[model samples]
Target: MSGDRGAVELEGVTKRFGSMVAVDSVNLSVKPGEFLSLLGPSGCGKTTTLRMLAGFEQPDSGFIRISGEYVQGVPPYKRDVNTVFQHYALFPHMTVAENVAYGLRQKGVPKSEIAAKVAEALDMVQMSKLAERKPRQMSGGQQQRVAVARALVNRPSVLLLDEPLGALDRKLREEMQIELKLLQSRLGITFIFVTHDQEEAMSMSDRIAIMLDGHIEQLGEPETVYEHPSSAFVAGFIGRNNFWQGVATEHGIRADDGTEFVASRPEEDVPNGQPALAAVRPECINLSAERPADSNNVTAGVVAGVSHFGDVLQYVVSVKDRDLLVLTPRAHAARFQQDDNVFCHWSADDVYLFSARQADIVMTDGDEEIHDN
Candidate 1:
């Protein structure tokens, strides 16, 4: 823990249980002071990846390195890493400072040094005020902060968290996200966070690695991964998406609902007459009160539902027999009711083009058949 407390590399790591593969061959590198999240649905191998990093499970193949040193035979206690789980796992009878000092005590550190380090760690998480309080005396958020302090106190090279805030209420959970992010920056330590909450990963991560069926689907900055998803699975999993099945053509694509729209995708990838998938984010779609001037990627629809969020409005419009989600800003939210005819328009760039995978089942309204214009 006294050396450079960052830099991790995973080379073609794979883990299997019995005949089932829990983790496929995976490669990743985390830089110092970076906040990286392993995001996916449950049983997608994200938690397994975290366990491998923490030395809880040995990889069936490949190698792992920490701070430029190979740790193939290293154990959890020997490695400069610590984990904070969703359950705080605090000692119910121990005071905050005592709980934080337990790790040091087990290491047989001197009494004077343990007291000094414990005080310093509690201060870092802004919890020094409640150092003497028991776990039952503090709120959930505060207790979680103490857990964080315990992990940071060790000053590990890498900190691993597995859904650390899953138990908190909505408002408190959001507040903790901000606090944890700020703490990571202030300490400048690498944080490897694992979570299934898409919004949590999007808001807190510097880079997100999306996993599906034990494979890494996409890895990039949050905006890059969100705005330009590489595959249909990643697009549908990372955020809310509306999809339509179509056939690729040189001009564009012809949806099964008879809506012809222009799209930008590689020729080699989108072979002519091959099946394709079209995806657009809710925020990228625009809702207009009247008919739009142009015809490129523009169509008419009726507002099927309107949901009022605090600062934004979510509109579901039925276009070409498909329910499309659109986001309207609060300031521009006009009185629009269900069944009102409206225009849905978007730029060609906003539309994501991906090859139609096996899970290309489209939810439609049974309005019209696809047409190629």
Candidate 2:
């Protein structure tokens, strides 16, 4: 490992499994101490990419570099990286301190050095008090911390986390997210996290590479990818969106239902008259009793359902043949009720227009469901 900084680079990397192409030609550059996430649904090749980076799986083509050195044939133990899997994978019989000291002991470090390093690692994760407790006696969160400590004991330049928080309950997972982020910031080590949860990626990643069908569909900061998606798939996957299939127009799109979308800036070009999709995020659509003067982006609907989520309220409005999801601040959400007539309107700036290349992936059979951020 280069002691200066942990910089990783993947150039035109490709991986295959028999007849299946798990990861397409992918290029990524991660700066030292940066937190980057490989985010996508199951079977999108996120885990494969992470495995390749950890040296557990070699790429079929292209090359990988770690800390400025090409690591094409380097084995997992030889690479300057360590991985924490979804399962804690701690030895059940080993105490917390013993578990953390296993790696150093395997490498034949001095007993005095191993003890000091084990204590430091346990202290880093606030698990020092549980150093004498076996994995079977500790809580899930504590076991997770031990797993992290074991990885950190090696002091790898880059840490690969594959859904490390996936096993915990929602609340504990959220708490771990904060701790892990703070830990990364404190250590200044490069972290490459992989997960299928969009919200997790958005909250933890400095930049996210959203993969789909073995290739990265888009790569950007959370806000950039959410507000200005490169493709229809990204717009739908990053967050909840109400999509309207339509034909591209000079300004925006004309929905098949006759609704017009005049976007100030379209995310993609569709050669005017080509099939396209126009999307608006749930929070962008405002519900009102009176229709706005601007007719281009206004439509009528009936409130089909309402769901309260602490400070936010989500509404399912039935419009013609489809249901549109809208989110509003709870303080401002009392005006509408189920079966009430309402007008849904949005600003052109909030509209996102894209070519319908990935419409099949975005559009589902039922109404789009809303998930809390």
Best by TM-score: 2
219-253 per-residue lDDT for model 2 (tens digits): 99999998888998888888888899889998898
The backbone clash count of each candidate, in order, is 4, 0
Give the TM-scores of the predictions, in the order they appear: 0.92, 0.96
User: Once superposed on the true structure, which residue ranges of model 1 sit more than 4 Å away at CA?
Assistant: 1-5, 265-268, 333-335, 358-373
Q: lDDT of each prediction vs. the true structure?
A: 0.84, 0.90
Candidate 1 lDDT, 1-373, residue by residue in tens: 3353598889999999998898899999898789999988778898889888889999999888887777888998888788898999999999999999999999998999999999999998899999999999999999999999998888887899999999999999999999999999999889999988878999999999988778888899999887777787677777777777788767667888888777764322677788887777788888888777877888899999999999889998998766888887889856578999998888777777766753442222222222222
Q: Pick the candidate with the highest lDDT.
A: 2
Query: Per-candidate RMSD vs. true structure?
Result: 4.2, 2.9
Clashes of 1: 4
